[model samples]
Target: MVKSHRKDSVDAMKNAAEILAVDSEIISRERNKIEQAKYNLNQLNNLLDDSIDDEIDFLEQLENSLKNPGDFKNSLLLEKLEIIGSRQIPNLEGISLIDSMEISYDWKEAVRLNQEYAKAYQIDLKHPFIAMFSSIELVEISKQVVEEFELLELDKLDYAFAASAGLIAGFIDAIFVGSIKSRADATGLQKSVDKAFDKIVELYGKHERIAELTNQQEKAKTDSSKQNIQNSIDKVKAGIVSASKNGKIVEREWTKHDSIKWLEKYKKVGYDAATNLKDGSFHIPGMSPDNHHLLSLAHEPSLFGLLIGIVDQITGKSTFIGNDGMIQRIVTDNVNKELSGNMVTQITQACENWFGHIMSDIAGSSGSKGRGSGLPVPGWAALQKLQFGHINYSERHSDVTIAELSELMFKKGYDVRSFSAQLIPVLVYETLLRCYWFYKQHFYYGKDLKESVPIANNRELARLLLISAGSFSTVDVTHAIIKSVPGSPQFIAEFIMTVNLPGLVDLGFRSFQNIRNEVSHRKHMENIYENDILIEYNRVMSDPSVL
Candidate 1:
């Protein structure tokens, strides 16, 4: 019985070993099948990738052909060759297939295809959103679109009309807008300045001071004797000095020779630098009492000048343009004591002082006889520092620099009010150009009134303005030449009065800007054209469908 049990166990163990071997064989076969399947799948994937790449290349060629119609025939021929080469035989069937393919470039079909492609690829070709973020700029694409559509399409007739209008306007400007000789002879502009000066004085509660000066003037007029007039002038000067003094600080006594004593304590802090023009104490080169307002940067009627003037008042320093056309600073030796306030309060006080001082200087001082050297136009001082060019004022002084000419202009009453008078011609030219542009665009071109509005940025309108301004400036130049003859008695007067220097400067600046803009625009357009195909490819590739 023991031997039989052992035999059964041995047989059972052998059967188990055989069963394990069979299972191992089956598992090895299954693993080999999986490996083979994976290899086949990889091969299929590679074939699909190559096909997709070929298709993409073909699509790119097609897109290029669409962009450049001139190359369409050559591109289509190449595509035909490719298709025929891919075929097993270059026989009649393949030739017929190539022949059957549409070769003609049809705009309607092209547009339809583009629309379908855009729709499928979830793109709007008309208003393409090429960026994932707003900051990502497609400058080339934008330029391409603008070049394709936003062209200025004005005709010869339009330009003719613009020129005619400008000529008429120029004539009007020469006749109506002459020169301002004095405040009393000033156009509406001087009256406006007077009213503003009066209002500013009233607002600052300095009317009493002005009233007293007026009273002094009235008394002087009543008594025309030279001695009596001198007395009244001396009293007026004394009153102005007394009124201008800051009582909070110790006063510095000035002599009768000090002409600018009225400005001794004008700002509570120090502002006056030169007591008189004859003395070398005035630091600014070529500065005179008549043209000091133009030479001194601190006295400029601008916010930047105001700030500089305030600093001068606080620090007891005077800032002016040097002989070398650079800024120079010097100690004033005028501040009697330190101002009593925090920085903010001091600044506020400085502003008040600046306004009051400007009012006193804007008109004339009580001692002034004529138009009184008023404040220059805001940027007029800058021209004085540009001491280039030579003008023959007279045979005695044959070579006067442009800087001297600027000063002469100021001395001859070319103040801010005069600058305003100069604008009339410019305004007339602009108005005429705009009206003609609108009339032509609306009536002849049949454009809407809104579209016909002559906005500055409109290329057509800008071109018209440039041409018109040129014509107007030409007439102004002619007027100046006709009026100002060399060696004539009226040469100085006519030269300064008739020549619209400001208008000429404005024209030159605008012309430069226009040319620069046109050049830049052309460069951008060229760049867009150079990379048009690449830009389109990139845009198409970015589409979700292409990905």
Candidate 2:
């Protein structure tokens, strides 16, 4: 049965290949006939022009003879008249002949034929090997072709709707979801971030060891003295540990002071201006204990951070941007020392420790007074390293780099929680544009709901998004300008707070990509025709008939 089924499959493929070859040959021959007919028509038109000119010349000679009665010849007059009468008039019949010879392959007709052929052979057109042969194309669809055909063209009304939606969204961004100052801000976005942080902290409480620290934190809240509170926080920090699958406890050595004491044998190498420069401990410059979560890449609350933190723990090294705007690596005294178990066991412990440490740092440290330093936004640390653009705030704070400005922003409470708040306005902009696009596609254009979902390789949707984002950015930039006027006393603060860095960066990148795509569109279309359509055509034409 298996052998019979295989043979049948082979036979089906062979029949399909033969059909494709015949079809290809027919198409090629018809195309050649059309080309030859066009050449013949041109030649015929040229001959007709010459014949008309000859008839005109003959008539002129006969008129001259009639004027001179003495020189007039009866035979010459008859010959001129005969020539005029024999000339054929230009007619539509020649055009009709060419039109009749022309070959046109409609996509619907092709599809119908494909279905009939597949049914006859009992072949599933969806089968991977048979799918390519199921459909044929005379012209492959490409971005340039789509544009040239005006398939995704937007009318005046579409432009108006997109712009209006963008304007409305921009206003929403500027009014309701203004600059993020702190996690506890009264904005709706900030409230959402606070809820997320609470959820994370709640999950952290599930761990047995972390739950004990939470209990200690509650007990310390009742104490009035600052000293007692500090001691309780330190005790909690020291008690944090990660347990492996086999129940082996591994202390977070790089972060915890007690574990650092065990690694006093290895020499610490590298400068850390943020901490004590003289101390023989691993440190990253500009990464103070208060702001390390923002400056240290390993302390970020992301998978990237987790991976980097694990590497740092096992290798006993810290990575951060130096004061000179360069990436700096520090070798701590914990290098070449095993914390617990084998290499894999140590890695697992490191991962767990990293997660627990980030959770603890994300909301704030145990000793924080109000809104302590939280983790920086994911990928925010990398952005902070771009130390370009010198701006003078005042005589005292002149020539401050972008990196320094970002640090100051973090100090003023623009942490990961605050970054989440900033996303609300961007979200509003995107949502409004998509909704407007969908409405136009469905109701205005008379398209089905599924087709009008504003998804997939949709050029019109992409164009609309670009325009909307531009409008939104314009309003945002205007707002930033109004809030942070040059020479104002609060210029720096207002500028950093008002300007949506992530949104602006995104818009800039998209604008650049759109421009690039437009410039290369013609080349892209040519490549598609040659590499995809022409190649497939040639393959069908040249491939040996399996039959």
Candidate 3:
């Protein structure tokens, strides 16, 4: 009886061991699957690139048309493309808002300005002069017409002008073309929107495992880390919401209503729903140490002069992140551009030297938080998160000090900004997402071309930092511009958070560049192409600066 009992116990132990083995095998299989999926994605990308090259070869035949400038538009292939374009084009209504808005706004402004003038120059309603004009009913009617136009909304000011002007011209010259409030532009708008996030996620993917974002994540198991990130995101969401109603929509009392009761009717609204990737999950790209390394170097006071000198060399030491009164792409396309050998080597060598010191210094990124009040100093070693972009932590900040630093760095951080500027243009097309896709933050104000860098063959020292999509369209940018001004489109920011009007503005500006390129290349282009693209890019990429 004792022997039989012992056998039963041994069998049970063996069964338990088998179950454990099966579980391990299952996990291994899932990991392999994920790896294969990643590999397949790379393979597809390579295939797609090869296809693009083939298409370029085919396009070479079309370049023949470039020789004939006037006859170029008559090209068979080009006409076919236009036919395709016309088919995809949106309806007239999409453009009606644009034309109407323009006409109405101009009319209102003209009327309003005229009314102000009349009040100063012609109004005598209260006195005998009023009787004089009023007795001449025809003149009074004309004045009444002007007064009516003046009462339109500020935005409608242009609409009124265009309508009136068109009427004067017999409606021949005042038809508006560009459309606002377009659902058709959604795709482009989303792309414009995605650019900011792409940048931020790109930053995180490259630096997710770095010391700055996820030092804690690295220590935990992957599954555990995922949970922690999710929890942190939830906390962040709550914090952002709780911080203020600034980002939310709510009703408050109006000045005319009972001041305390005004809150009942005057409600504010949150921003438009944020767009996400195809997958519902917020994608935190791969982890990297790029920013942890770059910012760490930038904080160095010792190299401040060299940094400035480098930026000056490449970006004219423009004394600021801008040059030529515009901000150009900091990153130069050295491969295509004819950069002299000396300049390229000097810039590259400088970067290597700078990177080396920042990564290896005695105090390095791990230095005491004493100077920064226990928070990771602006530039320090950190476990960077791959999904969310920039490093996030709370600490005391003296505006005066930051301002002083900005002023000092603006003057002396040329090399840093020069090389760093490269990151900004690249950043402009990036998406803002740090952690996973859930919490997005990124720079909203797209920099304008302050100065022109050599289009080809230039050198500069710069650094790349993580950005967030959330930050790109947040309250700090054009929304602030709108709020600061009355009846400005920026005011629409009061309603939309996900959409950055500044970004739209930039898009319009880029269209202008394309127009220039088309003209330079002698490509048969639309007469309105340049202006249209300019407006379109601005409609998407405009920074608050434009306002």
lDDT of candidate 2 over 1-547, digit per residue (tens) = 9679656545555545544544544455466777777777877798788787877887787788879879877788688678767766444223223121222265345445655654654545444333333244423434455655445577887777667766776787688667666634536656567567755564443333334445655666455654554554464455543435557755442222222222121212111123334463544565566676676777787888888888878777777765446676777544333357999998987776666556666666555555667778787777666778787654566777777777777877888777776766777767887888788789987999998998724667777777777887888888888878877867777777877766786578667766765656657776776677556655764676622
Question: Candidate 2 — what's its lDDT?
Answer: 0.63
> Least accurate stretch of 10 residues (summed lDDT) in model 3?
457-466
Please identify model 3 stretches exceeding 4 Å from their true place: 1-352, 358-478, 482-509, 518-547
Backbone N/Cα/C clashes per model: 0, 0, 131
Full-model lDDT for every candidate? 0.61, 0.63, 0.31
Ten contiguous residues minimizing lDDT sum, candidate 1? 92-101
The lDDT of model 1 is: 0.61
Candidate 2 regions with alpha-carbon error over 4 angstroms = 1-151, 182-188, 206-280, 333-339, 383-388, 436-453, 525-547
Error of 1 at 259 (Å): 20
Output the number of the lDDT-best candidate: 2
- TM-score, structure 1 vs. true: 0.54
Model 1 per-residue lDDT tens digits across residues 1-547: 8579646544433333333333343354456666766766776677667666777777777778789878577746487558645844212211111111122255346444544543554443332334211222456655665557466777797788767766776676567665556645654444455445534433333333344445666666455554554554555445333334455533233322122223323433344433433357655776666767776776667897799878887777877775446677777764534354888876776776776566556664435664566777887778767778777776655677777777777876777656766766677778877888888889987999899988867777888788877887888888777768766855765677777766787688669767876887788677665576346655754676632
Q: In candidate 2, how many Å is residue 210 off?
A: 7.9
Candidate 1's C-alpha runs over 4 A off are: 1-149, 156-161, 180-269, 273-280, 322-326, 333-340, 431-455, 486-493, 533-547
Backbone clash tally for model 3? 131
